[model samples]
Target: MKFLQWITLTCTVLIVSCTSLFCNMAYVTNEGSNTISVINTATNTVAATIIVGATPIIVAITPDGKTAYVANGGSNTVSVINTATNTVTATIGVGSNPTILAITPDGKTAYVINRNDNSVSAINLATNTVTATIGVGVSPFFLTITPDGKTAYVTNEDSNTVSVINIATNTIITTLAVGTLPRFIAITPNGTTAYVTNENSNTVSVINTATNLVTASIGVGIKPFDIAITPDGKTAYVTNLDSDTVSAINTATNSVSVTIGVSGSRPKLLEITPDGKTVYLAYEDISFVTAINTATNLVTDTIEVGPAPAVLAITPDSKTVYVPNSDNNTVSVIDTATNRVVATIGVGSQPLAITITSNPQPPHSLAGKKKKDIFATQTDRINVITWSAPSEGISPVRYKIYRDAALTNLAGMVSASNALKFEDHNRKNHTVYSYYIVSEDLNGGLSTAASISIS
Candidate 1:
């Protein structure tokens, strides 16, 4: 008799990216309707519509990929959404005009930047409560956390300075003066430097993390509002809102390498792909998105989306890009392979910010452990392989087992299936055998064996 047993999996607590070996989901905050639209990455459709706090402007997912923290600009509160069910589990009051979110790498806490209150609210992820309220600079609108999860950098628009916060103490340790009306902040992958976009000064201030001082101020186009760094940490792209242009900064030289013009589309914000090959820019008062090639620093193509696109988010595999149109009340899914709008998902009115839940799925195991583990056995004329089918966040859509290490010959398969175990009958006795198992999540994200030999 042939039999296969399925093991249930409990996902890890970290949410920065999907180590859970599952597909990603994009969450978009709708300011006009006090709701959030969840998009399924695979189908590019609205999976769920969740009501949140009033006038939510931005969102951040926890490291465990379980919950989304949303900042309500109008209600002065933060709504915590349970990603598994697409529901707002908690709503905690914050400062006035909470506009931005920066979650720590550890996923233990989230920092909310308040524009009118000149403060930051720290929420404890485990408890869903406001743990600390730290005062920052005047009118802080955007913030970024260090890769190490130790410090946070906030851009103060009214004071023209950047506030540096020590995560351990939840306090503003220092403030460094930058250009006029600093708006957005981004920290490099190496955690050594930070880039702040100064809107009024039309420049990007490069700050040394160790000294907390501006090391270089590279001039960009008019009203630089957003910044994105390449994965390799070699370049920085700044969107100039008024100039309708983007300035590429050479990180090594701390200078502007190229300025690509966006004709008639005032670029408001930009996000880079995971592979760092392209940059997607959202235009103000425009109905389309512009894709820029990072290599040539030129406009590669323009994709027509909805009216007045505001923010952008990319999946972990760099295969798709999500753009939320505030005016048209929808999110456009763009396939990176074609650079075309593959699907138009209806979200909510005035969708503002978007983020993906993330990569790194693991092989199947037996105990539903967060990490990878394997179990198999062979007896006279019978072979059985049983593993804990990772439910991760979403259940595995299908599972496959192979006899060879190369995974060429399909020994068994569960189509549109969730069976975790595979049994091979009529096998030769006293023969050495090897097998490989692969799993796919509901979001269409595949996690395969890194090595041909199943671990």
Candidate 2:
């Protein structure tokens, strides 16, 4: 009888300097000041601020976390920031008023939504230049790219429609009429379904990405402005602007699971932690943020931030959160463990949105099994392991394979290649052995693991 054991260890680390004072950074777009604030998360202070175009509203970071793209609504251009230098490296003219931005999964292209012109600009990341211009519904306010890097969905606020674009051709493949005014969109982790929040219609439109059709229209709180789905893709939380409540919907049944009321404050935007344990809400009319426990669907912590917090983002470690206070031009840093404001860093005038670069994530669908070494003539035994590249975030530079479950026993390492596989040669028969696999990015940040055992 033979026994073989396998274990996958996901080493997810923040891609930043451990030796230097600065580790992770948060980029905030200042609309009133027309600049970007770079906040160092380690010290909880502002590292630098770079000037950009007029009225920057949104920011998107590439998968590698080396570059940032800012949408300047007033100047109708996109400014590219080199993260290493913290400077404006390039500025590409987009459209009349670019309000939203999204980067593809491959990190090669960026799509900018110009609300006034009703068009989208595809910018090539390599050259930092506009490569294509695609038209969509009127007054497109938000955009999201699928996990496969093949399609993009845009919500047109004025036209009450969603424009589906093919990334390869840079053209609108279809336009589906949705609720009265679709303001924001969120895609599930698997990229199988997209949920669109219609502001005027007060309904959530669920779309099937495969057929590009509306699967269900879920009634929710009044004037739903923003939506975010859990990492597991099981539940979605929608913030109702006017009703001062958040509607949690079960993705499986497309039904409202619970409606948590924020009686005094109006919830403007929200995000769920990567671990899917807590849901944070930022209010436009108030100065505090509400943290809800995902398991119990109840309010766990109410943290006081700056005046009129506009938007917020959580770090990959799920230990810290950064919220841009639009009224005060400052960012409130909250510690996840205590749910208190640890520091407040002054940014620019009217900080609207924030985005942080992510650490490399573990490869998907990792599996391994014992097999015969066909190329060898000595009747040797081997273990062949295979996986798909990470769905998003920083790409790995190499994969390390360990012989022991504790990951202290070094076996071998493989470079990131198209093969997406590793092999352990000359394995002993009828003996139990364990293998551990992890991904390492260029900056030496390790990924979190997914386990797969071989018999």
Candidate 3:
């Protein structure tokens, strides 16, 4: 059996939000200021700002969540941010105009897309240096690693192709011709297929990973540029920029199943919560972000944000989402439950990308395997939490829970209780509350922390 290489939580302190657990340190790249804003999600504000290269466009977190690599388009370098200190510890030169980055699952390397040179730079994470530069097609923008970390697929915008790279050898094994102006790419959870969004063609090319071939091209709305796939890999969501809409593609058939309109023009980026319950998209023209319910495929809430909200990234616990406003020089924090702007943080000028990276749990441990289905409902003055039990290891002896980011006080001290649910009395309707759950085994072993936010 393959064992997980668990790293000491000392590498970096970037916030990683997902189903893995919880992280408070997330990083945002500011295009205008040439720096990265370190966001403390617990406070929904910018905690620190670290200077990097010029026009840093994309950031990638190592799988271990200890370090973040920022691609500087103007400086032709990559800045390594150590999460622990929120500082730029190292700078490695790469090809000119690096736009995107993808780290392998093992957290050992990062693949950077250099648009000007039409190549991908493989950086050694431990050494903080570039190991190899593999040539791809024209203007490569985005890349995604497979679940197994064996292969990487990069989207080339100008050549309209997807280059498949063998991670072991750091070489381009093959390139599959895709749609016009392919910009964003996503691989399914099962690692069977990859979906590339074509902006000019307004279509998404579904590629069979085994054969490295484009198996299907599904028509979306006008100018489909970005995409987000569900955790189960059952569906793919594409943001149609020109149409001001989002196309929901059913991955089973590779067809457009639903089209949800945005609040304003230029629906640039979209992301699904870790639970796969809601989809959030940023509207550049209207200065707003819209939240859509996956069940009914209807707009649930519309939040006013800074100018040109370009990217959406959610925390691991599905509690908070950060949207970088390109023109306003700010980042908007959205409370997932309330679907409102809880905080407006002044980042560097023209922040374009937001990335959350955290120290993840072991692959199959009680904490890693205990990804829970957390649900919250607010009725009048009370907020109730309901969740399925942890699936791995022994049943928890009792569930201990806390409210807010800081474990200030016990919500209700019901020790050794078997109740799978709890109700927080007297919670305001619009007040966002963060909860952390600890599952203690019979031998007094406290499992990894599971968290959620209720409003």
Candidate 4:
């Protein structure tokens, strides 16, 4: 039998709370309603509607997932929401017409882009106040925080330039000229490169973040509005509003790798799944979310959502997708596994951007275990091993041993109570055999380690 078939099955349960067994919540900023929407991922429902400020154009969640900050363009203030309570805990006054926001990795600071002011506001999370404002190029619309949270890159919409800000000092370190009307920015996972979407030029500028310079320019679709980098940092996805398509950029050569067409009229926002296998694009006019296969660069599914789906966000597990509909004042939740809309949650008007907190998966304890003791008879045959289990209730006492990475030995879960041993008889006498073990919970959460080598 295949390894996937041998795993035990468990009932899937949905839980809604501040602290979910899985990180399953969505934060949406509403521009028309002047508020933000908090959605429960499990139920695909709106838990709360928070009144933030005027024209909340974009929203960003802190790295720790404890708080969400919304940039209100009309009011020039950022509304801080406590994710646990789904309430606005504070209102931080920032620069004029804050259009986008980015938070530091430590979750202690935030950078807000002031479109009209042409400045970035640095907010101290602890005090919920703006500590400094750094001037940049014209119409700084979007900002991206580096992985290390030491710097922020802002895309100047009108100036066709990118500003690099030193987060620690709250100062503009340098500015690099790029394509016309840069609208969105994203940094690679390794923090080595940054990608900027040029709306007017219909291209993306690849910047070397270390030198704060544009290294290359890749032509994409018409009017690229938003951008996201794959988890591996090898590819980037950009949403083209005018062309109703998504452009995939290969980071290695800094060029357009592929383009996936969408059904909707204007594809405004884009997000990538945690596993980096799927990309989600939100269509603003038709109110739909299109799921694209990253490997194939094709639209695999389209999910009907609320009116004017403006933004999209995916949960840490990549099992759920949340979309904010600006026209209908609602948020739609899509179960990725089923490729269907599970629920439509009503919220404030004109929901603009959405983000989710990532839940931590249980650590694999077997990672540090010695291979020789774990697998004596079965080693050298397997190249890879994987284990997964559920996230809650009834701790898995132990795991079953298997020969081969595919677990083709010992039919099913054997009692680990007996020194967690498994033997291999199918292998030749002189041939090497490899073995592996996996621990899982009742909820289908599994943890896996390396394979054991034996001769």
Candidate 5:
């Protein structure tokens, strides 16, 4: 009998551990209700409704996935929620009418754009207090932080400009003129480029991060309001408010690649799935979340949500979507796999924007991972190569050497901790060979090909 009881206890613990590991959750900000709705991904159900500040317009989650900061437009404050408990722990006062918010990559600070005050308020996440207020243009609407978390690009609606703020100093560094009534801003994953949607001009401005200048302006559709880029950073989707269409842009050429029509009227917010396979858009009047097939750039299905859907967010696993309905003071949860509305969660008044905190932890590489510079010199009968470790924080794993597209185990397994300098002694005179390195993480995740060639 005791053995049976021990066996049962072991099984119960295993079940609980597996459930916790697989159950990802989606979060939505209810602007009208001043609350946030948390939906369980596994069951497509409401896990919790978190009360926040008055009129929460946007919510940003910290990088570590521990806290969520909500911008309350009506209350002129930001609500900090503890993700573990699904409760508001603190409220930081900011400028008036905070419409949107973004957290730095380091998770140390958050930038809130005050639409009425025409300024950006910087909040210290540790203390939950507004530390700096920087003047921006008229009606600052949306803001995006660079991938490196060093700079913030904010769209000023009435001013038709983007205010660039240096995160280190908490000050406005420069303002680049974009288009009329710029409403949204999106930064590339590489932190090298930025895109801004001009609602009045129906165009998207491409800004070069290095120069802080508008490099190109691509005509999109009627009244583009929200923009998002794919995970690969190859394509961008802009929602056309008036035309009920989504404009897809090719990042390489900075041109409109295609235009996808959304059956619902007034598509307001757009979000891409983690795998970059699907896009979820919220339509206000139609009260639905439309799912688009990214491959063909066409609407595949529409999941009926709450009344007057304001914003939407996708879970990190790409299995669930959360939509906030302004009119109903509720949030609708959608199952991505089945393309259906699974649950409706009640929250505080008017939710404007939602962001998720589930950034996947990259795989760790094996030891002795070798790396070589793309540009290396070779002497007579000798090839000299210099290499460095891959980007930090990445997994430290093993390396596989390749020559002329063929795998060569000559270097053996090398540690990723040290930079390697190798000389090819077996090279034939006047022969040309291409060398490459492959890193394998503990989880078997492989690095992209990094290659060098020598003659």
Candidate 6:
């Protein structure tokens, strides 16, 4: 499975280009109505409409497709929706104007961009709570993590800089200055380079991943609002909102090879299909989407969608396109083969953003375990801890070991494939350490912690 990464352009304008492996459902966030429209992709109909916080601008689904985190710009809260139940299970309060959220590849943590407060909240997926908050530059909006899940790059609009964060510690390692008003960012498939769009400077800053420095600044159209790289990482397409054009940049040379003029007034946001065959551009002023052929760099078809189509999401198979229309309070489903609208489903009022689940399956019920056991032994300087899964409940997929009795300090974790064992190397020879073990499943369910003491 391809690692799911978060891509955000701005609070008002953003695009999520994810390679969902088994995507079968689409979740659209309605800004005006403060609700979510869940569309079953197989049936092309609204299966459920869930009410969220006020002015929900963006929504991100976990890689497992079991949970979704919605950023409420108006209420300064993130609504966690359980995909299986189609309901908001928890409402997490974050910084002011929480506009974007990015989940880690393991589905264990989520980092939310609080634009108004200029901070990022790291949420623990297991507990559905904020674990840490890291401060960043002024008016930060754009965020994208590296492919390896080790680093995250954030664009600060007012500061004109990019904050590089270490994923494990959730701290800022460095902040590199970029062009003025960096709005959108894209990292290559190889995790070697990152391309950031400067809205005010009318250029894109290319950064070296190894050095974390601005290596080159390539000039583009009037105002580059959003950017998307092809799956192959050979070319990156940038949408120029003011110039009404799309600039194709060659990744190898870091130069503009071709500039394609778009028909609409403001070509605001765009997304390249996962198959790398087509690029769809959404216009802010017009009611249609212009499809561009990546092979020829030419406009292929202009399909009319609902009025004010704010964002677009293409399915993993590249067979369908889903666009959320903010003005009409509906979603337009387009069949990719024919480039036509197959169905228009009514949703909440003013849908601003949409994200489809990669594997939208029904929720599995996991019974609680009644008994579990853990044993620890000292070998050299390492405390080797092993546990036995309770025979009372369903089979567990992984185990988490905590050092503190509060279970807040994580000691180590071992997957079921790792023989259900964890080694703690930070043990002191003369001190007694209390360890807690919790068994977990793929659906984010945790068993009661079993305690053990080692001296």
Best by lDDT: 2
Error of 3 at 38 (Å): 0.9
Candidate 6: 10-residue stretch with minimal lDDT: 7-16
- The lowest-lDDT stretch of 10 consecutive residues in candidate 3 is 362-371
TM-score of each: 0.82, 0.79, 0.77, 0.74, 0.73, 0.75
- Model 5 regions lying over 4 Å from their true place: 1-21, 348-352, 359-455
Query: Model 5, residue 192: displacement in angstroms?
Result: 1.4
lDDT of each residue in 205-304, candidate 3, tens digit only: 9899888888898999999988989887888988888888899899998999999876778887789998799998887577888898987889899888
RMSD of 1: 6.7
Which digits, one per residue and each the tens of the lDDT, describe model 2 over residues 124-216?
999988999999988888999999899999998888999999999998889999999898899999999999999899999999999999989
The sequence of per-residue lDDT tens digits that candidate 4 reaches over residues 194-268 is 888898998888898888878888999999889999999999999999998888888998888888888889888
lDDT ranking, high to low = 2, 6, 1, 3, 5, 4
True-vs-predicted CA distance for residue 411, candidate 4, Å: 24
Determine which window of 10 residues in candidate 2 has minimal summed lDDT.
Answer: 13-22
Off by over 4 Å in 2: 1-22, 362-446, 449-455
Stretches off by above 4 angstroms in model 6 are: 1-23, 360-455
lDDT (C-alpha, whole model) for all candidates: 0.78, 0.84, 0.77, 0.72, 0.74, 0.82
User: Relative to the unseen true structure, what is the C-alpha lDDT of residue 406 in candidate 3, on a scale of 0 to 100?
Assistant: 46
For model 4 the local lDDT of residue 153 reads 88
Question: Which RMSD values do the candidates have, in order?
Answer: 6.7, 7.1, 12.4, 9.8, 13.5, 15.4
